[model samples]
Target chain A: MTTGQRIDTVFTLFVRLLLAGIFAFAAYMKLRNPAAAQAFAESIQGFKLLDPLQHHHLTVLATFAVPWLEILCAAFLILGFWTRAASFAMLGAMGVFIWAISTVIERGMNLQCGCFGEFSFPCGDTIGMCHLVRNSILAAGCLYLVIRGGGRVSIDRLLISGKPKVERLGATPTPTPTPTPSATPTRPVSSRPASDDTPIALDPVRPTPLSSSPSGVDAAQPPKPRWD
Target chain B: MRFVGRVALILILATVAATVHSLYWPIYRDLPDRQARTQRAPVTDAAAQDGSPTPTGRSELPEHYISVARAYQFWEEGMPFVDARTAAERVVGTIDGAIHLETRNFIDGSATRLLEELDRAFPVIVFCGGGECDASENVAIRLSGWGFNEIYVMHEGYDAWKDAGYPTEAVGGG
Candidate 1:
């Protein structure tokens, strides 16, 4: 493999591993206290997303679901199975997280994020900018995968055999064109056509002018006053 | 993938599960619901300027008795000590000069006619057994209900008084 390709492969692997580790840790912390998880959800002020989950069971369910999704995505990415799909899922989760945090901050609710619970590194009421920065970096990585597709060592690549079929060489002869001006323009229409095949003309015809005869006497004007 | 990471993950999961279990386990287990049943009364500040009787009615004593050196001080001041324990328990130990009012009859005021005969202003130090006893507080509450204003629960109770080598007596059949 070329040096550039090798570097790209290494970078992709590193991103996948980093995402997996982060998600796994986050899931573990949340699974600990479902109440704290519920509180964290309530702290994200917009739309009252947690209102319906005010009950204990629903709250616990939400706590489980979020972390479960994170873990599943992380596992998929780590195993290099459906790498692009997993990365996209992670990206989506991160977007929701960012929105939730921003909403919480905007609404001015003081609460622990429960991201790490009591084991949180620097003690504070809210999850600080560090969490956002970390998630943003992870998000960028996921977006990269979304665009670039999975790199070497991915199961997706292995499962799908050789290189994608290229246009067949020397088969299906290129047609020699007989240029005809048959009223249909060759240029593709930039704007949507009014009808399926008909091309609209640029210029249109104007109406005829009146004749200047003395008998006609310019109906309304009356020969422009004698002073003229 | 490393051995250390695997071990760390296991340890973390175990610790988290244990903590969660501990916090919630009591809810399901038949543990005593102390917070619900037993109310801790606010301790009266010693230096408070008010000579008015500290509002003892608001407090809820956990057991029939409470350890009270203050009630002992009251006893030293020539106040009569009232033993509110059952006749059976009184046989074990009781304070000297303490009148016997068994747990049931004391709070019900079966001895009301006898008590009413005494001077209303005389200080009465009420107590039962150790700090776990609520009988003292119950008697005190009953006395307060019966128009006895100077009722004080000997928080330490008769047991502590006897333990301190201060005084003791056996009353009734015991």
Candidate 2:
């Protein structure tokens, strides 16, 4: 690989690592023991997302589900296993977090963010706009992963490396494209119809294809089935 | 189908893992109303008087939750109330004679001298900013850890106390 390609790989790896590390530590803090879990439950209660009396079952479910899901998805991120799916789950979680934070802010409630257990950084001690911004940024990263998969250094990439491409029934023939982490914009071929592709990158790291293709994405293939 | 299905699968895995862990793990395995049940106050004065932690064998103690009416009754009986809400919340008014010893006070070690002043054997009444607030419960837990024999949390909070027309004084003459 060229110097640029190697750097890109390392950068992709770094993004995955950040996602894994932050989420894992956050999950561990909230799940270290029963007291920690109880504290987290109280934090969830503080948000008053659901009336503790009216939505008792849902409140309880969120208390148990949030941290456990975080830990599980963080493990997936670390292993790069089902990378997009894991990221999609986290992205959904961040949406809930953002909504919860906004609700508390709207209610003018100063709440303790039990986000990283007792550790609150970058957003101060209370849940506020800063916390919302932080969650938004993390959500963006998750969206990127959902769109781009986990990149070349990921298990997602490794799994797809030598697999045969699954093109749509009516797509035109083209050369098999290399498995680059990003959409090879300048180096595209027949996978996507020529007029239907975006030649520019969306993120600093990579751009999501406007449409998703099955595994073993050869940039050269015709436009295949999309998420849409 | 594959992408969405995989995401659903991740969620399923998370839910299953949480169910298993919550059901099986001793910590999470405790009853749901554990906060009310788990009082860590010293079993007896022997260990407390010795200036040593004696958290062992606390099964006999009852839940620390007390209704607002009961709290008022305790106030009439001369039990000192502890305000566990933040300074801003307390500025409006507090249970007359209630001392401000919020959770942050304990965390920052500022509540130490005040804690020293209160008798460990006293059945202290703690309250917070009211509904959905756990500050009082948190302070009660800390007090329990400090060997305070009976620490009751008024979960309905200070608002309920005031709404009931109970005797309340300005926290700082406000």
Best by lDDT: 2
> Which ranges of candidate 1 are over 4 A from the true structure?
A32-48, A52-58, A122-125, A162-228, B1-174
Tens digit of lDDT per residue, candidate 2, span A1-228?
346656766766677779888898888877776656656766777786667556755655666688878888888888888888899999999998998899899999877888887667777767889998999999998887777667666677656643222323334423333344454544333233311112211222222343244444454544443321
In the range A135-207, model 1's lDDT, one tens digit per residue, is: 6777898898766555665665555423221111212222233233344354532343321112222211111
Task: Give the per-residue lDDT of model 1 (tens digit) for B128-174.
Answer: 77544545554565454445545566677666777787866667434
Q: After superposition, how far is residue B85 of candidate 1 from its true place, in Å?
A: 43
Q: Give TM-score values for chain A, per-prediction.
A: 0.60, 0.70
Task: Give RMSD to native, each candidate.
Answer: 26.5, 11.4
TM-score between candidate 2 and the true structure:
0.63
Clashing residue pairs in candidate 2, if any? A190-A221, A190-A222, A191-A220, A191-A221, A191-A222, A191-A223, A192-A222, A192-A223
lDDT of each candidate versus the true structure: 0.52, 0.68
Docking class of 1: incorrect
Q: Model 1: DockQ against the native?
A: 0.02
Q: Candidate 2: lDDT of B98?
A: 92
